[model samples]
Target: MNFKHMTAAAVFAGLIAGCNVMGTPLPDPRLSGRDAEFMALAPQARVNSQFERYLVDYKTNEPVGSIIVDNNAKFLYYVMPGGKAVRYGVATGQDAMAFTGRAYVGGMQEWPRWIPPKDMLERWPHLQPTADAGGLPGGPDNPLGSRALYLYQDGKDTLYRIHGTNEPDKIGQAVSSGCIRMRDIDAIDLYNRVKVGTKVVVL
Candidate 1:
C-alpha cells in the first residue's frame, strides 16, 4: 500500500482500539491543540458516541475529498479511499430551512468575520444595529467560530457554509438557519483536511 493508505490503516486501527475501553478516555481526533483554556470557556455538551469520529464501512461512488451530509442521520461523512470515511456530528438547518441537493466548497477561511445575511437581519431585527456597523469580528463570541467552508453552485455563492460555532451544545440538533454547524475543534480538523472545489452532497 502507498503512504496515504498506510496512514489510513493506522488511523483506523487506532479508532477501533479506542472503542469502549474502561480506562482513560480516548483522545479526541478532532481537537488539534487540546486547548484547555478554550475548553474551559466553550459551552460544554455531551457528545454521543455515534457523533465521535470512527472508521466506518462506507461504500460510495464518490471519490475521495467528497462530503456527504446525511440530514436525517445528523451526520457528515468525509469520503476517504478504501471504502472508509471520517464521520462527524453536525447540526443542520431547521425543518423548513434545510438545504438539499449539491454544492461545492468554493472558499475557506480561518477565524472568518460573519456578515449577517439580509434575511437573517430581517428575521432578527435586533441584529440590525450590528449589521449597520459592518459585521461581527472573528473571536470566541463570533458565531462563525474558527473555520468556515463556503458553499457554492455553478460558481455562484449559495450563501451556505459548513462552519464552527461558539455554541457547541447545539451540535447534533437541527437548529441552524441554513448552514451546517460543527464543534470548533472538529471544524478546525475538517478545515485542514478539505480544499476548495470539494464536492458536497446534502441528503
Candidate 2:
C-alpha cells in the first residue's frame, strides 16, 4: 500500500517478467516453428547419449533381423549386418516387473488414436472409457507421439508398444507403464526402416 512497498512489488514483478527466476527455460522459440523436427523422421547424426546421437547398425550389426533391448541401458539394438547395430534411446516400463521376452512388429500406425485400456481406467477412476477424455490428438501431446509400432506375439496384443513420446527428455529411462518409447523424430525414423513381423527381443 505504501510507496516503498509498491516499488518493491514492481521490482519483483519485473524480475519475473525478465526471466530472473530460476526455473526450466522454455523450449527454444526457434525450434517451435521447426515442427518437422518434432514430427518427421530425421537422420540421427550424433553419437553417445547426446540428443543428436542415434545408434545405427554398422560393421557386423545392421538390423540383421535380430533385435535386442538393453533395458538396463534404456537402449534398443537392432542387430544389423556385419557387427553393427542401431542403438536408440527408449522409455521402458516403470516397474521392475515390466515387459520381457520376444515379440514382433505386427503393425504400425501414424498419429494413432490412443484408447485407454480397461486396466488403466480401473487404476485411474477419473479416466474415461474412451480416449477422448485424456487422449491427445495425433500431434505434439499424444503419449504415443508421432509414430507407433504395435508389438504383438502369437497374434495377440501384448498391451505394449514401441512408440514415440512427446517428452523426449524422458528417453533413456524407465518411465512408461509398459511401452518401448523413443523420441518422436527417432521413432519415425525407426518406423520407416522397420516393418511388420520384425522379430524383437527384449531382455
Candidate 3:
C-alpha cells in the first residue's frame, strides 16, 4: 500500500470508533496559545454522533488536497492522497442564500474578525450597530470561531467563507446566511491541512 493509504488505514479504525461511541463525554482537543485561550472560554456543545469527525472511503475525481462541500449532506470533505477523506459535519447556508460553484482559498486567519455584510445588516437591522462599529473583534464570541478560510473566485472576493462557528450544535443543519460553518476543532484541523489557493467546490 502507498504511504497515504497506509496512514489512512492506521487511523480508520480509531476514527470510526469515534463515530460510534455514545453517551461518553467527548474530550477537549489539545490546543495551545491563542487557540487554548479562546476555546477554554468558548461554549461547549454536544455534537451528535453522526456529525462527529470521521475517516471514510471516498471516491472522487477531484485531485487530492481539494475540498468538497455537500450542503445537502451537511458535510465537508478534505480529499486525501488516497481514496480516503476526513469528513466533518457542517452547517451550511440556507437554500436561497447558499453559494454553489467553485472557488479558491485566497486567505486565512486564526480567530478572524467578522464584519456583517451590508446585505446581512439589511436583513437584520439589529446588526447595524455592529456594522457601524467596524465589525466584531475576533474572540470566543465571534461567529467566525477559531479559524476562517476566505474564498475567492476569478481574483475577486466571493464574499463567502468556510469558517469555524461558536455554535457547534448547529452542525448537520442548513441554517446560515451564506458562509459555511464548522466546529472549532474541525476548523483548526482543516486550516492546518489547507493553504492559500486550495480548491474548493460547493455542491
TM-score leader: 3
Superposed on all Cα atoms, the candidates' RMSDs to the truth, in angstroms, are 8.6, 13.4, 7.7
Per-residue lDDT of candidate 3, residues 1-203 (tens digit): 24455677677876767665432223435799999999889867988776777766789999999999999999898998779787888999999999999999999999999999989888899999888899999999999999999999999999999999988889988899889999998899889889999999999
Candidate 2: Cα lDDT at 107: 88
Scanning candidate 2 in windows of ten residues, the lowest lDDT window is 22-31
Query: lDDT values of the candidates?
Result: 0.82, 0.69, 0.88
Candidate number with greatest lDDT: 3
Q: Which stretches of candidate 2 lie over 4 Å from their true place?
A: 1-52, 56-63, 129-135
Q: Model 2: number of clashes?
A: 22
List candidate 3 segments past 4 Å from native: 1-29
User: Candidate 1's residue-wise lDDT over 30-147, tens digit each?
Assistant: 4435344454466656777677565576889888989999988888988878887778889999999899999999999987889899989889999987878889977667798878
TM-scores, one per candidate: 0.81, 0.70, 0.86
Of the candidates numbered 2 and 3, which has the greater lDDT value? Answer: 3
TM-score of 1: 0.81
